[model samples]
Target: MAVIAPAGDRITDVAGITVGHHHRIDATARVADPESPGAGWATGTTVIRIDAPSAVCAVDVRGGGPGTRETDLLDPSNTVQTAHALVLTGGSAYGLAAADGVMAGLEALGVGLPMDDQGHVVPIVPAAVIFDLPVGSWDRRPDAGFGRRALAAATVDVAVGSVGAGAGARAGALKGGIGTAGTRIADGPAAGVQVGAVMVANPVGSVIDPATGLPWAATALDLDTYGLTPPDAGDVARLGDLVAKQTVLNTTIGVVATDAALDPSSTRRVAMAGHDGLARAIVPAHSPLDGDTIFAVATGTVHPPQPDTVPPGMNRDVGLLAEVCRVAANVVQRAIVGAVLAAEPVAGIPTYGDVLASAIR
Candidate 1:
């Protein structure tokens, strides 16, 4: 039997989490002249804010060329075990500056670690960026201001695709953007725990199957999430052309949030498992050219299910941790598909919908 997600099917389904996007769509010009001032300014930033001032967080970086900020602090051995915000943005290495803006915003709200006797606070905002420079105005990428605007616009109602950090994203030969999905553990030891993920899809690989004009993650798609139609003969035929045009500069970054109470080490494992979703959706993922990363955050709202017994060498929490990890991977896969499906064509790149429509036409 297929497992269906609860209504909303979004990362916000996890309590106390809100998402916001800030992107520039005005620059639609192709990346013909890389030296132009606004040649690739079609990028933006996405902010994931945790209402909890100090949400326990962990990160897993699988790609070889990741561009990130403050990730070292997320290490299990680091003194700070929590973060106030997570930023995902486009503009390659330059986009890491956006996290500084997020930190400034959090500081204004008095949300962060207390630092001095004078009531100073330092917001723990970790961030990651994708290389969308080749697709849009590379000269005009995201900056600190973009992060500030995204944080200001944070809300439970998220806007997916061609927005925020996904604005300039590209997946193989198709357009890529923001996508989110969530599910509740229904019948496991972790039942009632909510698991969710939000991703900025700009992989250096294809999310579609060449054999059919459909997403590789189609089996996990929910009702009407990306439409139920399968690719026609023509769509399948275009796959060869699309595959031939594949390039190498890209990355996919995201966060997996859950209501289950998990320690930092357990959360790190969840973050690692979350990458399975990326592998399921994108072909040839985590390549040396891609900077794929996933962060796991636990709001500590729901307690893990208690195991009946604990063996001498094993811990009782392992069962519940396994269930959370499983759900985390599933939601990540769903979110990646949602990102591709929700995407809109920009800078001459065709979206999944555009490809399907062209195929049927």
Candidate 2:
């Protein structure tokens, strides 16, 4: 059996990839106070920048209400085969403006496709937004400046929890936030390949199973490493109360990246497989009210495995691409759970950590 192990516990573990985040949190005193300045400022922006000039990219939008920009250009048949950056943001449609700032930033850095010899380069930045207006004042969502700051702050050390697009996010009845995880292929045909996922888990459906007050995928995935156990009746009751009040529509957005060399078409397959992880972690995923989107990028730093046997149909290693997809799905699932565990409460909503801790009477 090929061995795969967690690496760096962040999306940045995928070489040539860096992440940045900028957000505003609503004040306790001014919670939902529309009259206050920046009172409803619990939204933010997250940027996933490709550090190697450009990289093959693709997207999978499973939710019914996605707010996106430049996604069509990423199609395998499109003229643009690579992307400079990807934006996962709050602010719904309005937040799409953030990508503009990223484009300008990349332009300043001389990163993008060369359009003319006169130093004119057009950066291909694709973006998606999660509806987080209800978290704060509707008008206080992310803007171009948010994107700019996040891009400027890009680094390999990713910070999970209540930051970036997940600052005001929710998972079912619990608070939601950012999370990341990485995997390294070892002792396999694709040895040294790196796969990682970073997700903002703000879903309309529950991340936890109501019956157990624990994530639905935890048992099957052996997520005891997160220190989560079946909750007592008190914990279940508390979760029930929160679910009743969590009526705001929201979505989950993320980026899954790999170091393997893959074409746009293969990258798209990776993106599609990532959603399986989302479905595993969040109950009733891809709901009509949710705008779940996952962007997949291939840095192409490592060559994908080639069939070692002649007459390729007989080789077991022919399933190398399938292995990558499976790893992508696994990392995504772990990232969602990481988000749930790392989250902090917003506006009076309690985090899963809080509920679990309070139950320990």
Candidate 3:
């Protein structure tokens, strides 16, 4: 079969996947008083749903400080290798409550494993959170309601930037937000495999190149997803000044999905490779203060190549798996860039566009 890219370049491009967001942006809080802290509410929750209730899943966590739930169950040796849903949110550890809401929502929809002779089912949902309390009102963090809302709103047309889990996110000195990207394997043994990524970018490192005012992943930009422009010398100089103000508390969390068939071990490898994409896009990434985590899911839509049928050098199954990993990393890098570019300024945090406008002026 020939590889055909999806019309939507976002993570929803992957078949059997849907994304949703629920956030609160307080008007008064938007206008923060430098003298007074925690004035606004700019945090929210994002949920990624797989059509298959038991899709194969794995997680890779590389940050020094990670706030996650049910990650241990994802281990290959664990009893449950499948996941029903995944949650990403802002609010530090407090945001974890949102997962409870997701569980309830899924339960209501009759999704999850059968508990016993009774009709009770338990949904396996893993969750992760980024520290956005510094930018938004700590009092108004994500809760069960936020998770339910996000799940209820799940759709193929995902909204990116300054929303969902990325609402209170900041990338170094610039605003951070939600972003997604996807691609189809055009050729080779992995032809027709569809891979995509959704990221809530709130990193402690820089996503832009100080020397060019462009995303470090500029080479991977597709269709000018962020409306990028070449930076002038002045813009470059300004970026240098901004990097000097790095902070120590932040995280970049996300999920990657593929239509290709993969077991739990393969999914774990893909998740690890996804971090490579993060490193490529963000300078000084996976820092002690950043809880950078990536989750991988395979819907098993397309079967891997048979080892016995393919050429020896090809190692078809292994080669295709590697290709999926490569695409997963690139998509992640692009997603991070998309988050920064599409973000709207909030809570006095400047966006990439705001910085661009200032530098050009």
Candidate 4:
């Protein structure tokens, strides 16, 4: 029996993992907040592409108010399926339109599912957005150009923080909104599987340190101090008040993937696995106003073991995936926190660093 090969962060399960971003408008031009008034007003898009074998995919969304397009295609029941692109942007629901440009890019390459008589190339593009209500001055929206640019720049080596949709974004009381990512490996389902996570943090709540109430090691004094903080149980009473505000300081969108040889159903299981990663990392996640969506992809270029193929020395591998999931979730959670702190203050948004300092090891 052949042993499954292992792929770390730099190498495959998902090889050629690339990311790209496009800034359509400056912050002063468009804003999500009117009352506080952000420093920069603008629009932008973040595109994450995973070049895989066949066009098989799966997803799990746990959001009361989600703004997405082409999500229905991920259903195992759907026949016309083939996803090549995922768009993450800043215009809240308006950002869904950014998929148009990506559609054009994919269509040009003859990607996507088969079309009917009308030549309607059904491109599978799943997207999520962050509320920019705090940067309330400019007209905020995502356009086809933004989508096209994001797709055009897609690559395997992607950067994190204060870029793309994260531009002019906010979190907590500090400058917010941005993308962050991480990867890990395990033994069984985890062995030979390289798990990676990428996310954009934009939440409608305050950020505090998990270790300490002040946010970060001791109290953070930086304008961008950001750490980990789960919502206090006592604050549940004020839930109604928090939801009523509906501001730009809200939500974080993310995708987690592995180079595992799994089908849509299996991938769905893995995607759903991310909920734990979210729960462990984010405070008050999956809220009514937040759209926390995770996408799982399998780049079949690297073949691995099947789920049924249980053998010796495999239990350790399973532990690896479990650990990978934990690390991946924690990394994404920090990414959300970093997104808030790394951003240059827009309008009058507080930053993660301003609210809490980073305790990332």
Best by TM-score: 1
Using lDDT as the measure, the top candidate is 3
- TM-scores of all predicted structures: 0.93, 0.91, 0.91, 0.75
Q: What value does the lDDT take at residue 69 in candidate 4?
A: 78
Cα lDDT over the full model 1: 0.83
Q: How much lDDT does candidate 4 score?
A: 0.59
- Minimum summed lDDT over a 10-residue window in model 2 is located at 29-38
lDDT scores of the candidates, listed in order? 0.83, 0.82, 0.85, 0.59
Stretches off by above 4 angstroms in model 2 are 1-7, 29-39, 310-318, 358-361
lDDT of 3 by residue, 266-352 (tens): 889899999999999898899998899999999888874544666667534787789999999999998898888778878878778
Which digits, one per residue and each the tens of the lDDT, describe model 1 over residues 174-234? 8888888988888767989889999999998888887777777466334356565676778
